[model samples]
Target: MSSVYILEPPTSGKVLLKTTVGDIDVELWAKETPKTCRNFIQLCLEGYYDNTIFHRVVKGFIAQGGDPNGDGTGGESIYGEPFKDEFHQRLRFTRRGLLAMANGGKDDNGSQFFFTLGATPELQDKHTIFGKITGDTIFNMLKLEDGLIRDERPIYPHKIIKTEVLNNPFADIQPRLRQVEVKEKKKKEKKPGVKNFKLLSFGEEAEEDEEESTRVNEKFVGKGKSTHDVLDDPKLSSKTEDVDEENDDVEEVNPEEQLESIRKKLKREHKKPVPTSTTTAEPIDTYESFLEEERREKKKKQFEEIQKEIQNVKKEYHKNKLKKKEEDIIATEKKVQEDKTIQEYKDEFDKYKNKKDALPKKGAGREQFTLNLLEKFKKKIQSMKDGEENEEDNEEEQAWLKHRLCFQDKNPVLAKDANRKDDDWFEIYDPRNALNKRRRGETVEKFKK
Candidate 1:
């Protein structure tokens, strides 16, 4: 007789959660699956994993958590038993603040679990590889993108205020993603310029002839030193040796007494004597060449009236192009007889969709045989409408509405009877059957024969 298994992981403490959306810290695989790590540390040490949540989220995958009725098949801690398959294989569901376990299909592991959000080799051999969130001060901000963390829920709702445990000390380091993003580095474009055509060879080109530029336009000289040449330019002085050292210290002012002091300040005054008629757009060389020969005879009579209005618009555009080509050949023979009657009704709807797998699907007792042939033709026209409207005795309530028929709405059992009622059987002048009153009594007995 021998079978000892003191499994102990019911949460030896250390569950820190405290989260508006971050901190967590699980660490309970108590020697691999010890009864699902002691039923998830005895349901987070009795407080049943506080505000439990992490529902099902699956962005990068895995964030689940101990349920507390937040759906995901809720749970508080019903270890009523079941757990043995640990399946480790050198444990390593890869990185990013690990933590595992969560099952229901096989030996239903307890106290659900999750948290990885990173490397998940196709969920290794299909789940149940228990515990790993070795360290969790938000595992140094758990960033692995495409799985956002900060506040976007997952294992996010944590806020356990505090937790503590030892003997494993926090040396599990292995986390990273400290922000990285960099990005903006894109400028390298400038390629459009390819116009090349230069062929010149008219005897090796070079012929610009205006008599060799007329001696450089007679040695061009206007402002080459005129218009008061910036105070008699000395070669436009850049302060000509500081004005010859301030004129070697003073006074050297008269160049012909500076042109008789610039012609006595160019004097002026008014001298009107008489004549003053002004208006002048003068081109009257012989009355403006006789009004340019009467404006070339009124522009040759408006170019013969615009060539008779362009031959009456080319004879009304060939009489409306032969009346629109006889109305487009009578609308193309009525669109080829409406495309041969729409291709003979699309070849009879492609022979009823290729005999739609041989029709005849009407049966399941053909709706109770069409509701017992429409309630025996509506109780033979409602007992001839209650024997001509309330002249009662409707043949035993029309045989009980023909056995109350109604297989899938082929409806029938409404044999009206609120106290011998019969307002012309809800009529617009009733007589709704018997083939419409025997075709109106054979059209009034064929008009009274």
Candidate 2:
């Protein structure tokens, strides 16, 4: 008796995805795909996947989500950029409820993830399988799959409400929260006319204006002096009267001339020598200079090595591409040769048919011609069958031959006609049935049912 082997889910890390439809419990395969698992765990803890809808859901394939944009275009890994895929030999999309990362291309793994609806052999090596549904969560996956519409999307908005980390293997590791700096709004400066509106009233506007004038006069005269005392000073009064008389005697100068004078004064001031200061220069550090030079040399050598590697890769790629082209050419040549041989047989048959029409109705010559034609056809078919047998080891050749034979069988000339039911030539040499029988190790005899 053989003992049954059961694989247990890992307890190292687990997460519960609470969604609009149902909750899904996932067991992370941390040991096999650590990077993918860690990335998913961090994104979940950071609430990056929260409230994100399943943007793409294909029935019987996968349920993709984790894109913040609600479309399939947005979302990034916890590393803040696309990360490389972590494909483990043991992990694969061999069953329903498997968790994997959805990528746009190679090494383009981001925050987007998907749940397999069934065994997806086509996606085995393409995606990184990091986790699997545990317990009765397969029911939730089924519900999700069933909700998909014709457009490969859920009819309703199916979103992940929140993610709860059950057990984290890297407990010490915390998510790198993005810091958004808020800009403060600046206060607007009030205009001088608007600022003084409160100081003046409708009724006492004149009195306030007078008081403001006296305050300005006292401020310039002296801090402790009143407007009356400043006006009572004889020397200040005489100076003010003389300045007013001089301004009245002087003619108003042209605004343009005043600006030109100011420009000249500024130019003269600018022409004056600028004061220079002297300071001691700090000595250069020889050790730091040496280290920098060595670092540059190392970078140059690394760059050169990378260039050489790129060249080698290009050479190998070109070589493989050329070899593939040569193989394709050889295959095409063989197909052309086979087509030419078939066309030659057809031309010969046409010639024989034309000759029979020209010959007598009841004669030995016509009968002999018909027999010869049938024998030639039989010989040609036998040779083709022998070729198929010789190339039985080559699957590609067999597939090509099978495809060609099926195409010929579908031709109007070879296909059975309802009007003329007596034609049994195609039945005896039916390549489709013969190929199937040969694959099953059955002996194929010429002109035998």
Candidate 3:
């Protein structure tokens, strides 16, 4: 399929796009992406891109358009469906003013296309490049008023007013075949070895040093200039001529004129008046000076005393700060200890209460039998309490167990009333659970604990 549609390019082919900003001339790469060029040309000829907008315009990036829907969502080809991408190595998007197709994914080119504003090497081999923008229309478009550009979408609407093929001069030019990028061979790593030293003959060393000196001199003095080259330069030669003329025009002075000038200098010196020295008196000391000196000494001694006081104050403040911190630490320790003790008491209480509740109620058959059973139960409870005390001492437990054998539930039912008060055996705290109690004509408390 690729061999059947090889590009037979012309000398040159260009498309003139008249946009709202300016007219952009694009040179089509017929020899590179022949199918893309054909698709673009067919669309232009059919007037399919006349009113489309350049919906996507990213500054310093790309200006995309050619969607019939004007929002980059719609495009159609002369042949139904979409066409495959025609990529060529020479047709890369590595410079400004690049023309290429816009597709949803690989090889989905239709009528949509884009022109790059600068080099986009990252898009290489990703999009088909069938043409390149020419002329200064791109620069003009950049200068256009940007009403609003959000998310790279041109909200102001730079529509394609018109599109036409200006020229197609590549009718006979065939596209050079695409070439694959070849990987270069890696350099071999150098092995460890003794450094090689070359011996130079005495004569060779001298010659090399001489050559190096000559090169150094050339670098500093630059290339030697010919007579003609010097003469050709107006600024340098003119300045030299002016200097020579000035030297030649100098006049000579006579010895008698020099003597007369020296004598005149001596006479002028003698005629000048001599300046007199005026004496200045030293400053006299007064009684006020002594008093001022004494006052300054007193103030200096006072400042020293004040500095000592400030030092004492800072020391006192530091001591107070340390004392307060120590107090806070002691308080925090006491609070943590109290909380631990309270938590331990609560846990022990809950354990003891559960054990007491689990004990069997007084069995009803005979008073003597019940009394004997109660006595045995009391002894077992006492033994368990003694065992716990021996394992861990608890003041609260000792007080609680003192009345444990005598304590009883407030709603306890007698053996005779057990059958008749069966409905009241269990405490119902919630109102919903009181339905049965109400039906049985039994009184219910707001709370049962």
Candidate 4:
């Protein structure tokens, strides 16, 4: 159905694929796959498949070949590009000897093809089936021992010596063979007063020869006569009455007489005419006319002023409109920037909250740490009061006092008064009470020493 041109197969409509094992004749589906058939035949005639091996072979499946690499990896079409798969309902791989294209994926059928060892319905609609093995010899050859079919490679090489076309339809360009040549004769020279003529046909050539011979035999002669010899002179006649009167006494004249007549007429017309008696006319002035002129000037001035006022108004309106549009654009951009910033901040807050919830609670660790610091601080202060500590010890005591004062009574308060508080998990006023309770064992050990 495609408009692409295809080469008609030979009268046999089959190609003989001679292999190492045997020769298998295949009937190419020219009508169904015009482009694919044309490409395959061209490659065959060019000897591209010569010396190529059947790289892929399966015991009970299919045998693939036509790969130039001979490793089941490389092959290409005539166009240097892949061709689309052509599948038809009548060309199903439902039986053995079915020849179909080998492709990497959809519509990527290249030069590689396969022959089904048996019924391979699983391959239907996935590859382009372009031909089919025709004879019983090919079917028998397909059953030959292909050795171990590991990695889909034939252990024994089955090389394709060459493909042969029994009777190619386009073999002879011309029905017959012949050669042709044409030799042009040189033209004869013409005499002084005679014109040369071309010989168009056999009859014209004979007539031209006779005319040439007659002229050669004749002696010197003047130019031949024309039809004007029998007609009256054109200058002696006139088509109109005025023309006839102008030429009533006219006679044939020489070049000198014509020149003299033209000169005399030109001199007579070139003389300047005499000036006539005339007076200059003055513009009539009246009161109504003067008032009209004044009113016209006044209206012209007012029209110019009105034009200027309109221009100014239009300019002001255009400037204001442009300014408003710019302001609106700037405001919209600022609003968008603010929204982006707010979104970033919210994202950061969510990340921090998730991280905090995932971490192990350090409340009990902090309570034990604080109790150790208090014990150390009390010992250092008592040593300093006994004059057994240095200046550094005094400084350390001051830092401890600062820490204690900063943390004093800083715990969160409850909704009820402290007087209502009790030593229970719910009634405890301190936020760290849970940490201390968990570390009660450690606290008792420390106080015992």
Candidate 5:
């Protein structure tokens, strides 16, 4: 049941206009919006749109056309009744492939409209979109944005050389959160003579036109009588004012002076002063911006300080631990080297010693160690002269060893031990004991001699 403005299966009702870069085929949307579409289609059939150019090109945005003067303000029907706004339920200004009406504000729509060079889905639900461009010239126009003008175009020089509204001139424009210039409602009027809201023109053109002897009196068809031969005068149609936006069949704006007067009313309601900071002590905007900058700088400084502190803590912690470890290692090595007796070696050896079995005993196992066990029996070896050799335990042990060796007491006691338990083995306490023990047979022979 919805009245959608879609192109039929070869998908549209239009003739294709080929360009050097691409083709331009427009599918009209009159089916969805009858009046608005009819107006544009009539103008096309009248040869009114021919030789007009894309007066303004915005990169990544739109390329405006339908201006005979190559200046933005020049398009008007033979008489100047701006077309009534067709708020269609079916069509929208949704994307880049759109061909929509362009207005100064509100009902200011004239013969001039714009075409989207690419997809702009973000523009949906807003502007009074009438149709879409159906051909490849969409691409050709896209490249025009980059030619000499990066983002904005010349409203003066680039004009559409020839135009053919080949088929359906009523197309749907994709819509969106549109700018003030593209809005559907009336805007507050500007302070009279404050700024040029009408079509923008160079001051030089006005001077030259005035100097010409022949005055241009070309009157637009539907608009009221006036001397607006050049077409770019930024005026609105008086007939199109205050029409119900929700209704499809509303009257268009005409009667220029009346439209201008109503605009004056709206202007009074919405007028605003020029934008500037209002601060008693200092400019509010400048001070706020300055404070924000200072806060950022403070944060940066704090971050650097924290980073440096973290590095220093890590370095100091590692340095102290390394220093203490080195000192401890040096001290332990010095202690080991300064030890006199090979105490470490002896201690290791004695760890498994069977002390009861290794103690010196008399006769068979004992005295060859030459430790003089008699002295150790009770620590009686007080001096080398009156030592334990003269003690009773020493004399007895020495007698027992001599009986075995068959040596007289006059012979130096090579070794001696206490006459003790039979289970113990004699352990050598003196270095000489080892040599004498090994030379047991020789020692006996020498003693006999």
Candidate 6:
């Protein structure tokens, strides 16, 4: 008998899930799976399950949903990441309507949940059972399951429209709700071409707006003209010609005078560099070279050490493998020697040897019987030896086959040849076969015919 974490049905801690199909009242197992219950309740209070559809549903199995992505890959816990699974011996998916967290692996529980449509013993210890459908609301879960198509998705979107917390056991503890930051939608900016356009109203208002539109169009008329057209205008073209002629009359300066003034200005702006002693410069260069050489030596030493470590590790691994093989061989030999049939044969041979030693040497019939018994013993011993040899041969064949498979796996061409169904045993053994012909210094094309 197992210890029961939940002795009675939970009355206070319950949640009302109003879905598109019908409402489902689930009682939380707060005592058994507190963290899982808390997470579910917090998500409900935050309205995370709202409008989320039951993405997966299977007849006589489960109805899974609560994924904000509407598929199965979204929704996080109240903690913002996957939480640890809370499994109780007593709290299991033994009956229908049990609520459990769906996870990818161990301790990977998220906000996605499932309702067991029937007894699911396989999922007992795997998923964390946090709640169970109470009262007649279990029929609603069945209704959702019934509405599923061949792909396990509902024909119509059976969405969880609202989630209301009817009773909160951890209400005094203050729910640890994740702070969801509402993203503000960016306002679209009007295009530059449409910015100056004004809306025209109808009737008497349209006449007044038309006058305003005329004024606006006139203001933007020059803005629409291209730069090339503006420059080609008669008034602008004449002004540009006058400016060019005026620039041609300006006096030119002597190149030698300009160069002299620039040199004087540069001399005032910059100062001369002071010369350093040769002795100081030489030591600095030598010291830098020495440091570089030391660094190179250190790197070389580290590389050598790493190579040695790798060799040592390889040697250790090989030694362990060889040791394990030797131990296995010894164990098999011991088992063969200690077999009941072999022990029985040994006992019978010992008894016969004692009887032969005690018998009188006069009777020919007694001697013939002893001879026949010895012959039978010899045959039995030979057969045992042959059996052991056969077993050894089988072991060798298995090992060779395993090695061949591994080799084929490494080479795709070999793998394809091994997988070919057309090749028969005779073809493999035949000297006229392509591979055999090639190996025996004959043309493969000649053998193909």
- Which one is best on lDDT? 2
Candidate 4 lDDT by residue in tens digits, 50-81: 89988888877888888999887898887679
lDDT of 3 by residue, 99-191 (tens): 788889987888898878777888887788787665777675564336688888866878888987787543543323336599999999999
Flag the better candidate by TM-score, 2 or 6. 6
Model 5: lDDT of residue 11: 26
Model 5: lDDT equals: 0.61
Please give the RMSD to the true structure for each candidate, in Å: 33.6, 30.9, 28.6, 26.4, 36.9, 38.0
TM-score of each: 0.19, 0.39, 0.35, 0.35, 0.32, 0.40
**Model 6 CA RMSD to the hidden true structure, in angstroms:** 38.0
Task: Give the per-residue lDDT of model 2 (tens digit) for 1-449.
Answer: 01111343354689999998789999888887888888999888888898999888888889999999998999888776888888876666667888899998898999999999987999877888888888997898778766537688777758999999998888666888768799999999987662345555563777677687778776677455544554655545332333444445678799999999999999999999988767777777999899999999999999999999999999999999999999999999999999999999998799779966887567897799789878865765676666553433355335435543322445456666666758463444565786878887888677476
Candidate 1: tens digits of C-alpha lDDT, residues 1-449:
01111232333324555543556566555555555555555444445556665656565666676676765676633445656557655555665556777777665666667777777887776676656554545453353223435544544343333323333322332222236589999999999985332344542223343334454456555525333333445655433243443445567787898887676655321243457668777666998789999999999999999999999999999999999999999999999999999998998788778766454468886677678768866765676555544344356455545553323546578877756757655534557655778778745456577
lDDT of 6 by residue, 1-449 (tens): 12332553454489999997789999988988888988899888888899999889888999899899998989888776888988776676667888899999998988999999988888867899888888899887788866437688777768899999998888654555558799999999987763322353345676667677677678668576444443446544322334544446667899999999999988977766667766643455778899999999999999999999999999999999999999999999889877867898888789779967978677897789789879865764575555532343344235535421111235445334655666563333786677786788876565578
Query: Least accurate stretch of 10 residues (summed lDDT) in model 1?
Result: 1-10
Where does candidate 3 stray beyond 4 Å?
Answer: 1-11, 169-449
lDDT of each: 0.59, 0.80, 0.74, 0.73, 0.61, 0.79
lDDT of 2 at 389: 36
Q: How accurate is candidate 4 locally (lDDT)?
A: 0.73
Instruction: Give the CA lDDT, 0 to 100, for residue 6 in model 2.
Output: 32
What TM-score, to 2 decimals, does candidate 4 have?
0.35
Count of steric clashes across candidates, in order? 9, 0, 8, 0, 49, 0
